[model samples]
Target: MPGETVQPTPPGPAPVPVPGTLVVDTSRGDRLGEFRGAAGPYWSLRAVCGGVEWEAEPGAVRRATRKERLHAEIERWNARSRGEVL
Candidate 1:
Protein backbone atom coordinates (compact mmCIF):
# COMPACT_ATOMS: atom_id res chain seq x y z
CA MET A 1 0.00 0.00 0.00
CA PRO A 2 2.64 2.51 -0.95
CA GLY A 3 1.60 6.19 -1.57
CA GLU A 4 -2.02 5.39 -0.64
CA THR A 5 -4.21 8.30 0.54
CA VAL A 6 -6.16 7.75 3.78
CA GLN A 7 -9.81 8.73 3.54
CA PRO A 8 -11.62 10.36 6.49
CA THR A 9 -14.57 8.53 7.96
CA PRO A 10 -17.98 10.18 7.63
CA PRO A 11 -19.90 11.20 10.75
CA GLY A 12 -22.94 9.19 11.78
CA PRO A 13 -26.47 10.39 12.56
CA ALA A 14 -27.22 12.10 15.90
CA PRO A 15 -27.95 9.82 18.81
CA VAL A 16 -31.56 10.03 19.99
CA PRO A 17 -32.66 9.29 23.54
CA VAL A 18 -35.31 6.63 24.06
CA PRO A 19 -38.88 6.89 25.36
CA GLY A 20 -39.94 7.02 29.05
CA THR A 21 -36.99 9.26 29.80
CA LEU A 22 -37.74 12.09 32.27
CA VAL A 23 -36.52 15.46 31.05
CA VAL A 24 -36.82 19.20 31.71
CA ASP A 25 -37.19 21.57 28.75
CA THR A 26 -35.63 24.96 29.38
CA SER A 27 -37.33 26.33 26.27
CA ARG A 28 -40.63 25.76 28.03
CA GLY A 29 -39.75 27.38 31.35
CA ASP A 30 -37.94 24.21 32.39
CA ARG A 31 -41.18 22.25 32.28
CA LEU A 32 -40.91 18.53 32.99
CA GLY A 33 -41.86 15.88 30.44
CA GLU A 34 -41.18 12.29 29.45
CA PHE A 35 -39.41 11.54 26.18
CA ARG A 36 -41.75 9.85 23.69
CA GLY A 37 -39.29 9.71 20.77
CA ALA A 38 -38.72 11.80 17.64
CA ALA A 39 -41.33 14.19 16.19
CA GLY A 40 -40.01 15.26 12.82
CA PRO A 41 -36.90 17.39 13.50
CA TYR A 42 -37.97 17.87 17.14
CA TRP A 43 -38.50 15.35 19.92
CA SER A 44 -41.95 14.43 21.23
CA LEU A 45 -42.60 14.64 24.99
CA ARG A 46 -45.62 13.82 27.09
CA ALA A 47 -46.60 15.40 30.35
CA VAL A 48 -45.80 13.37 33.47
CA CYS A 49 -49.46 13.55 34.48
CA GLY A 50 -50.46 11.91 31.20
CA GLY A 51 -51.65 15.21 29.83
CA VAL A 52 -51.13 16.74 26.41
CA GLU A 53 -47.91 16.08 24.49
CA TRP A 54 -45.48 18.67 23.16
CA GLU A 55 -42.56 18.86 20.78
CA ALA A 56 -39.18 20.31 21.77
CA GLU A 57 -35.69 20.62 20.43
CA PRO A 58 -33.34 18.05 21.93
CA GLY A 59 -30.81 20.72 22.80
CA ALA A 60 -33.40 22.55 24.94
CA VAL A 61 -34.08 19.51 27.06
CA ARG A 62 -32.14 17.77 29.83
CA ARG A 63 -32.78 14.94 32.29
CA ALA A 64 -35.17 15.98 35.02
CA THR A 65 -34.08 16.22 38.68
CA ARG A 66 -35.32 13.87 41.42
CA LYS A 67 -37.26 16.67 43.11
CA GLU A 68 -39.03 17.51 39.84
CA ARG A 69 -40.03 13.90 39.31
CA LEU A 70 -41.50 13.68 42.83
CA HIS A 71 -43.47 16.88 42.36
CA ALA A 72 -44.88 15.70 39.03
CA GLU A 73 -45.95 12.42 40.59
CA ILE A 74 -47.73 14.24 43.37
CA GLU A 75 -49.49 16.47 40.90
CA ARG A 76 -50.71 13.45 39.00
CA TRP A 77 -51.97 11.84 42.20
CA ASN A 78 -53.82 14.98 43.19
CA ALA A 79 -55.37 15.23 39.73
CA ARG A 80 -56.50 11.63 39.95
CA SER A 81 -58.09 12.22 43.35
CA ARG A 82 -60.11 15.05 41.84
CA GLY A 83 -60.96 12.85 38.82
CA GLU A 84 -59.09 15.22 36.56
CA VAL A 85 -57.16 12.29 35.16
CA LEU A 86 -57.76 8.58 35.14
Candidate 2:
Protein backbone atom coordinates (compact mmCIF):
# COMPACT_ATOMS: atom_id res chain seq x y z
CA MET A 1 0.00 0.00 0.00
CA PRO A 2 1.18 3.48 -0.74
CA GLY A 3 2.41 5.60 2.18
CA GLU A 4 2.60 2.54 4.40
CA THR A 5 5.56 2.37 6.78
CA VAL A 6 7.92 -0.58 6.93
CA GLN A 7 10.10 -1.70 9.81
CA PRO A 8 13.51 -3.11 9.03
CA THR A 9 14.85 -6.07 10.91
CA PRO A 10 17.39 -5.18 13.57
CA PRO A 11 20.96 -6.32 13.14
CA GLY A 12 22.32 -9.07 15.39
CA PRO A 13 25.39 -8.86 17.60
CA ALA A 14 28.86 -9.31 16.15
CA PRO A 15 31.92 -11.27 17.29
CA VAL A 16 30.79 -14.83 16.75
CA PRO A 17 31.91 -17.27 19.39
CA VAL A 18 34.31 -20.16 18.70
CA PRO A 19 33.15 -23.76 18.62
CA GLY A 20 32.67 -25.51 22.01
CA THR A 21 32.20 -22.19 23.79
CA LEU A 22 29.30 -22.09 26.26
CA VAL A 23 26.64 -19.46 25.69
CA VAL A 24 23.19 -18.63 27.03
CA ASP A 25 20.31 -18.13 24.64
CA THR A 26 18.09 -15.46 26.07
CA SER A 27 15.55 -16.10 23.34
CA ARG A 28 15.07 -19.64 24.66
CA GLY A 29 14.67 -18.91 28.34
CA ASP A 30 18.41 -18.55 28.76
CA ARG A 31 19.10 -22.14 27.81
CA LEU A 32 22.77 -22.99 27.98
CA GLY A 33 24.45 -24.57 24.98
CA GLU A 34 27.80 -25.34 23.46
CA PHE A 35 28.52 -23.23 20.41
CA ARG A 36 28.71 -25.49 17.39
CA GLY A 37 29.18 -23.05 14.54
CA ALA A 38 27.32 -20.64 12.30
CA ALA A 39 24.08 -21.54 10.56
CA GLY A 40 23.81 -18.90 7.87
CA PRO A 41 22.42 -15.80 9.66
CA TYR A 42 22.12 -17.70 12.96
CA TRP A 43 24.46 -19.53 15.30
CA SER A 44 24.23 -23.23 16.12
CA LEU A 45 24.40 -24.51 19.69
CA ARG A 46 24.01 -27.89 21.39
CA ALA A 47 22.90 -28.66 24.91
CA VAL A 48 25.54 -29.31 27.57
CA CYS A 49 24.22 -32.85 28.04
CA GLY A 50 24.58 -33.41 24.30
CA GLY A 51 21.49 -33.48 22.09
CA VAL A 52 20.14 -32.13 18.86
CA GLU A 53 21.56 -28.72 17.97
CA TRP A 54 19.46 -25.60 17.85
CA GLU A 55 20.00 -22.32 16.10
CA ALA A 56 19.74 -18.98 17.83
CA GLU A 57 20.03 -15.36 16.78
CA PRO A 58 23.44 -14.00 17.63
CA GLY A 59 21.94 -11.06 19.45
CA ALA A 60 19.91 -13.39 21.63
CA VAL A 61 22.92 -15.31 22.89
CA ARG A 62 25.79 -14.22 25.10
CA ARG A 63 28.72 -15.92 26.73
CA ALA A 64 27.70 -17.86 29.82
CA THR A 65 28.72 -16.45 33.19
CA ARG A 66 31.03 -18.42 35.46
CA LYS A 67 28.10 -19.44 37.64
CA GLU A 68 26.03 -20.47 34.64
CA ARG A 69 28.93 -22.47 33.26
CA LEU A 70 29.37 -24.28 36.53
CA HIS A 71 25.71 -25.09 36.69
CA ALA A 72 25.76 -26.51 33.18
CA GLU A 73 28.74 -28.70 34.06
CA ILE A 74 26.97 -30.03 37.10
CA GLU A 75 23.87 -30.69 35.07
CA ARG A 76 25.90 -32.64 32.54
CA TRP A 77 27.49 -34.65 35.32
CA ASN A 78 24.13 -35.43 36.84
CA ALA A 79 22.72 -36.46 33.48
CA ARG A 80 25.63 -38.80 32.94
CA SER A 81 25.17 -40.31 36.37
CA ARG A 82 21.54 -41.00 35.53
CA GLY A 83 22.54 -42.54 32.18
CA GLU A 84 20.77 -39.78 30.37
CA VAL A 85 23.97 -39.16 28.45
CA LEU A 86 26.98 -41.30 27.79
Candidate 3:
Protein backbone atom coordinates (compact mmCIF):
# COMPACT_ATOMS: atom_id res chain seq x y z
CA MET A 1 0.00 0.00 0.00
CA PRO A 2 2.85 2.36 0.67
CA GLY A 3 4.42 2.21 -2.82
CA GLU A 4 1.39 0.99 -4.77
CA THR A 5 -0.51 3.67 -6.65
CA VAL A 6 -4.16 3.68 -5.68
CA GLN A 7 -6.30 3.10 -8.77
CA PRO A 8 -8.79 5.87 -9.31
CA THR A 9 -12.38 4.89 -8.85
CA PRO A 10 -13.77 3.90 -12.23
CA PRO A 11 -16.55 6.14 -13.38
CA GLY A 12 -19.99 4.68 -13.83
CA PRO A 13 -21.61 4.10 -17.18
CA ALA A 14 -21.78 7.06 -19.55
CA PRO A 15 -23.82 9.69 -17.78
CA VAL A 16 -27.29 10.53 -18.98
CA PRO A 17 -27.54 14.15 -19.93
CA VAL A 18 -29.10 16.22 -17.17
CA PRO A 19 -32.39 18.02 -17.51
CA GLY A 20 -32.22 21.04 -19.83
CA THR A 21 -29.80 19.42 -22.21
CA LEU A 22 -30.67 19.90 -25.87
CA VAL A 23 -31.92 16.75 -27.52
CA VAL A 24 -34.03 15.63 -30.47
CA ASP A 25 -37.06 13.42 -30.37
CA THR A 26 -36.89 11.32 -33.50
CA SER A 27 -40.37 9.96 -32.90
CA ARG A 28 -41.86 13.30 -33.84
CA GLY A 29 -40.05 14.62 -36.89
CA ASP A 30 -36.86 15.03 -34.90
CA ARG A 31 -38.12 17.97 -32.90
CA LEU A 32 -35.42 19.55 -30.75
CA GLY A 33 -35.72 20.32 -27.07
CA GLU A 34 -34.07 20.24 -23.70
CA PHE A 35 -34.12 16.91 -21.87
CA ARG A 36 -36.49 17.12 -18.92
CA GLY A 37 -36.11 13.68 -17.45
CA ALA A 38 -38.82 10.98 -17.36
CA ALA A 39 -42.53 11.46 -17.18
CA GLY A 40 -44.30 8.33 -15.97
CA PRO A 41 -43.98 5.87 -18.88
CA TYR A 42 -42.30 8.39 -21.15
CA TRP A 43 -39.41 10.81 -21.22
CA SER A 44 -40.09 14.53 -21.03
CA LEU A 45 -38.58 17.21 -23.26
CA ARG A 46 -39.03 20.95 -23.40
CA ALA A 47 -38.67 23.18 -26.43
CA VAL A 48 -35.38 25.00 -26.64
CA CYS A 49 -37.14 28.32 -27.00
CA GLY A 50 -39.19 27.51 -23.90
CA GLY A 51 -42.70 26.08 -23.87
CA VAL A 52 -44.83 23.42 -22.26
CA GLU A 53 -42.74 20.32 -21.86
CA TRP A 54 -43.89 17.28 -23.77
CA GLU A 55 -43.71 13.58 -23.11
CA ALA A 56 -41.89 11.32 -25.54
CA GLU A 57 -40.82 7.71 -25.72
CA PRO A 58 -37.21 7.28 -24.63
CA GLY A 59 -36.40 5.18 -27.64
CA ALA A 60 -37.63 7.96 -29.85
CA VAL A 61 -35.36 10.60 -28.35
CA ARG A 62 -31.65 11.01 -28.78
CA ARG A 63 -28.87 13.57 -29.00
CA ALA A 64 -29.86 16.13 -31.59
CA THR A 65 -28.32 16.16 -35.04
CA ARG A 66 -25.79 18.89 -35.71
CA LYS A 67 -28.19 20.75 -37.95
CA GLU A 68 -31.04 20.39 -35.51
CA ARG A 69 -28.90 21.61 -32.62
CA LEU A 70 -27.77 24.65 -34.55
CA HIS A 71 -31.35 25.39 -35.53
CA ALA A 72 -32.53 25.25 -31.94
CA GLU A 73 -29.66 27.47 -30.79
CA ILE A 74 -30.43 30.00 -33.49
CA GLU A 75 -34.09 29.96 -32.62
CA ARG A 76 -33.26 30.64 -28.99
CA TRP A 77 -30.91 33.43 -29.98
CA ASN A 78 -33.57 34.99 -32.15
CA ALA A 79 -36.15 34.71 -29.41
CA ARG A 80 -33.81 36.41 -26.96
CA SER A 81 -32.81 38.96 -29.55
CA ARG A 82 -36.46 39.84 -30.05
CA GLY A 83 -36.96 40.02 -26.26
CA GLU A 84 -39.42 37.17 -26.49
CA VAL A 85 -37.36 35.14 -24.06
CA LEU A 86 -35.28 36.26 -21.14
Highest-scoring model, TM-score = 2
TM-score versus the correct structure, for each prediction: 0.70, 0.76, 0.72
Q: lDDT tens string, model 2, 10-78?
A: 875679888989999999999999999998999999999888999999989999999999998899889
- Clash count, predicted structure 3: 0
Clashes per candidate, residues 3 or more apart or on different chains:
0, 0, 0
Clashing residue pairs, backbone N/CA/C < 3 A, model 2: none
Name the better of 1 and 2 by TM-score.
2
Query: Relative to the true structure, how large is the alpha-carbon lDDT of every model?
Result: 0.85, 0.92, 0.80
Per-residue lDDT of 25 in model 2: 95
The per-residue C-alpha lDDT of model 3 at residue 33 equals 84
- At residue 60, candidate 1 shows an lDDT of 84
As a whole number from 0 to 100, the lDDT of residue 38 in candidate 3 is 75
Residue-by-residue lDDT tens digits, candidate 3, 1-86 = 67988889985533466887788888889788899887666888888978898998776777877887788889989998899953
Error of 2 at 70 (Å): 0.2
Ranking by lDDT: 2, 1, 3
